[model samples]
Target chain A: MAVSSTALVDEVVADVVDRVRGTLEDVFAAVAQVAERTTAIAAVRAAGRAPTTADLAALRPLLHERLRRRHDLISGIGFIAEPGLLGDVPAWLEWWQNHGEDGLRPLLPDLDPGTSAYSDYTHWDWFALPRATGERAVAGPYVDYLCSDEYSLTLSVPVQHGGRFLGVAAADVYLRHFEAAVLPLLRRLPAPAALVNARGRVAASTDPRHLAGSLLRSVSGRSCGPIPLTLVTALPAPRP
Target chain B: MSKLSNGALHAVFAPVGNLARVDAVVRRLADAIELGLLADGEQLPGESELATRLGVSTVTLREALMALRQQGLVTTRRGRGGGSFVTAPDQPRTARLGHRLADWSTEELRDLADHWAGVAGTAARLAAHRTEPEDLVPLQRSLEEFEAARDPAARGRVYGRLHVELAAAAQSARLTKEEIRIQAEIGALICLALGEDDARAAVVELHRALLRAVRDGDAELARSLAERRVQDAMERLIGLRLTVAG
Candidate 1:
């Protein structure tokens, strides 16, 4: 009986991890498509000369179509240009997102560093990590007041044109929706379990003590997928 | 403050929880516009929809919009794709801030300062325990910006951003959201005290020291430094209030 129960626990944990990985991979796959298209456009534009802001802005319809088609998982999608990549502008982000029944809407963040309201995207992990590492990244589970105001995870891929870094193509996934999709699988575990991001912040958890957004103290866990997320389970306390 | 897109929708449309619903709505909307959560010339949701989102009646929202218009923070259009639009206000003048400060008692200011200190100190402690060195980069950049900022308005923005980033480094979304909300309420007022070069320099030094403590993983030191930083700023603000009163 004991051996059977242990095997059952392992099976449940594997199932939850699989589902979590599958859901995130879907989002990343969508963002990867955006990055590929963006890179192709940038390469074409850069071949003639450095891409103009107008050149990049022309990609809006493409982004809008992606947002419309993937509205269930993708809350926002856009490209952020490397500073001075577009010549005149120090920084630029051309982003669009679903707006309930209104379809897609553009985001307008202040790019000027001098202003009190400026949002310097260079400082954010979602942009910074991919830029520094030249790799895809999952940046949050944090309240993203900059784009979605929802607790969200941002998936992003570095966009490069002929070995030159242009910027990044990114998408936002609302944490509530992520939880709604994953919680049922987590509930199958006999022990309390949590899904945590790279930094140990809980993304979703069956344990009230380990609420989403809180940090998980014990770092031991199984990596869920290509991403750095971990599935951490806490064994029930021994009988008193 | 508002960044554009769906985030702005959340900030602008989140329910107002105050008993004085109209006044609360007016303050919330005005704050959103001033903070740039609502872009200049951006159209607000239609009245009934906005009312439903805010959990207020259309009559109350109308009254609030009227108050916002009177303050020059919003403009309304009549027909044919007409709706209320945000008119971003200029930076608050010293005289205007003085008048706003006059509304708060010294005791209330002290209470707010204590609360602010508690939040910041706890966040710093958590950050020290949780954050990687690379995660501190934004805080470092913010400190450098604070040092370089010549004016109080710019310094105030850097100062508020540092604390918000500190909360984020702690990996607590609730704490980060709270920090953002608090900054919106007090950020403009902080400019009044930061106008002094000496005060700005002192803040820069304290922030630098606090960042170092967090980097070293000295949680206790980080907490005390954060608390001291808030208390010092509170004293400067109180002194400014007294001067304005006199």
Candidate 2:
């Protein structure tokens, strides 16, 4: 019994250690690419006409193509008048509720539902954009798309123009990209790593088996050594 | 449920009760019973007996059965008909990274840079601290190769590897998933419009600084430099208009 218990602890430690190391590496690599392209004085100068509607319209297809190429992500983006139909906070929430995956629905109750400024949604708004200049940044620890269960974390900086909201010219890195940083930290200890948004839902997790259903509020604080384990009391226990 | 002499089986599962592991065992049992690997309506040995045979404890074994029961993959009853019976097969669902990057924002992109620089720096520091002196040769070799490479595609490949290695070193799933999201988001974006030359130039400095940090075991310095490198790199993308001007 002692031997087996020791092995279990060992396995848990090993897994956490393994995942943390991975997360670190993954995060560095993913963040490293943020500066791959930029708005050169020449490039921005190339946009000399203040970007007319025709220019914008003509650019969508190419931008979409650009968006598609850069991320290969299911969700796509472009500069639009209304943040696009699904981009609006309320609409996106509603869309996600109705047309999205069940795994994602549980997170909605926590959304503020009042404005477009949720940290997860609009941190890129003028107010938050230039907060970081010639310095470090941690973006979206935030949400870009809710329906897809896509959570994001980024390393970025703001775009500035004489201290004006030149727009948040930054590289968008996905949260999953940080797996290399987080998982290894987790693998080092017996505890699992997960995020529970303010609404008391499982935001993201290492063991899918340890779903929002099985997560316990109590588990959030309990630590076995430095490794923390979420108990099955707070969230619904896994689908047992 | 069947009256299985699962004493041996229960013994086998006693120690492995984590839901995921148990889930797998139940799935296997479902397959086994269906394929006649274990007979239908067979009265298997008791948990102890089963545990003894499988080299697990009855507790773990029962947890597996319970999961199968919950999945409707098995049934348990008391008395003679009280054991575990195969009922349903297992199914799988998964998440993908590509789907994630679609909704990214400028702010989030920057955050990705911060996290990587901090955590990866730590991992490098740890590796430098713990790696055997003799083992440093291959590490140095890998570094040499990375420094020598200049092709964007090659850099991209190296970029992928450096991350996995860092993750393997930090050994955390949290880092791995975060890295996945960042890589998928950036990778997809680059595939969208970022040029090879653009990416290579952006990361070369960061990677080189990171190597230095690792070599020096300077976690803090590694983190700061790595972060600066990432932020500088991210600034490469052009910004979306903050709002549609009236």
Candidate 3:
């Protein structure tokens, strides 16, 4: 009976674990799209090709008129919380906040530090959470991208330029949307699956609490405490 | 980052006349519906420009217009100069899930029924297995209510609450939330079917089976029985054969 119960649990777990991978894939795809667009926009402006007033006309395919309009209308748009306070802040911070406020806010509201993410933690270091596999020394997932609020599954990526990390440009995608959007796309077999972050919090799952407080003490071949991850091998490694 | 001609590249904001630019747009559009600041067919600005003027974006403005559209106050025309215009609002779509019903397939109906039976059955089984004896009265009340309600919407609500109460009785919030979302989705699907009352009967029987299995502390039997209830339900949805014909 125990073995049968284990098998049934395995079937359900496999279904949920696939969702985690799906969530991660969708998130990564969205981020990659932003990254590509960012590089292109930067290149177009930096090419030093002076534009006639005609160049500003909405006829160019290279320019997203809506984005250009937004860049014009919305000052300092990128990956920050209070873009309104961008008055004296550095241009980098302004750029970060513009995208962060508009793009990340609706999708991942909990990650807004200015709103609710770090509202409880005053002056606490953002990168203090046990590192998953991404940034090594950055001080934040700055989950507090809002006005220092507590964020849900927020991640910070330090924008690197000329070897000095020019402040982090962050993007926080909601885990719930990740689960909804991409989880349905994952192919599942009879085995159970899981998405264990560096700290072992089960972000979202079919079996919500089955892995709560189930920490990964080491990424070195961790087993889910006797519930051998039968299909963990199929999941993608986190991007380096 | 690219260097730009500082002043030439300045952000151009369409000035807001007041606090409620987007609201003003809608109200103007609505009032114009009768007064002709808009005619029955005149076009308006695209969402982005309007949102920018209103200090909003296309999406936020759309969300507001969507509400008006829901209220049967406006519609959008396509093609050049196409934008939101006043319309005679139709009856708003209810939470009935009935509007999404026309494309509803028997397969979808059966899948929904089976999912509810299985999830709720497991929940019921768990409740019986774990609920304090004192908890039985509410279950009894819920059970009574499930049968007493007759209107499809009202019965659907009772059906959902029955499963919710059962899951809460099982003592796991994780389980209860999952069941709640499942129930909501199922509610939408259930509304599409003509035999929702019959589905209620299926839930009641499974509720009983779950109660018995849980009373026995038979987790294995409980889970499998829950699964069986789902199978029984799946059989009822049109267009599926249980056993393959040779």
Instruction: Please report, as a residue range, the 10-residue window in candidate 3 chain B with the lowest summed lDDT.
Output: B1-10
lDDT for each residue of candidate 3 in B36-74, tens digit (9 for 90 to 100): 223344444567765765566576578767865764567
> What's the TM-score of every candidate structure?
0.77, 0.27, 0.32
- Judged by DockQ cut-offs, is candidate 3 incorrect, acceptable, medium or high? incorrect
Tens-place lDDT per residue, model 3, A42-147, is 3454345422222222122222322244332221123321222122321212222224334422112222222111112212232222122235221211122223
lDDT (0 to 1) per candidate? 0.78, 0.40, 0.41
Residue A76 in candidate 1 has what lDDT? 93
Clashing pairs in 1: B2-B36, B2-B37
Which candidate do you rate higher for TM-score, 1 or 3?
Answer: 1
Identify the leading candidate in terms of DockQ.
Answer: 1
Candidate 1, residues B103-193, lDDT tens digits: the string is 5678978998998999999999988876667768877887887788776566666777888888877766777777776776667677777
DockQ of 3: 0.02
- For residue A221, model 2's alpha carbon misses the true position, in angstroms, by 38
- What candidate 2 gets wrong by more than 4 Å, as runs, is A1-240, B1-103, B132-154, B171-177, B190-199, B238-246
The C-alpha stretches of model 3 lying farther than 4 A from their native spots are A1-240, B1-99, B103-118, B192-199, B228-246
lDDT of 2 by residue, B1-246 (tens): 232212112212233334355544554454334322244345555677666554556787788667656655566668865765544343420011122223345576567556665655555554444332322333344445555664433333334445544543332445544554444334323322224555555566566666666566565675566556555555653232122121
lDDT tens digits, residue span A1-240, model 1: 112388788887787798889988988888888788888777787656777777777788788887878787888998988887886577788888888887788887666555544457776788889999999999878667676556789999999877888899999988887888888888787767889888777888888866786666556887897877999886333223
Measured against the true chain A, the candidates' chain A TM-scores are 0.91, 0.36, 0.42
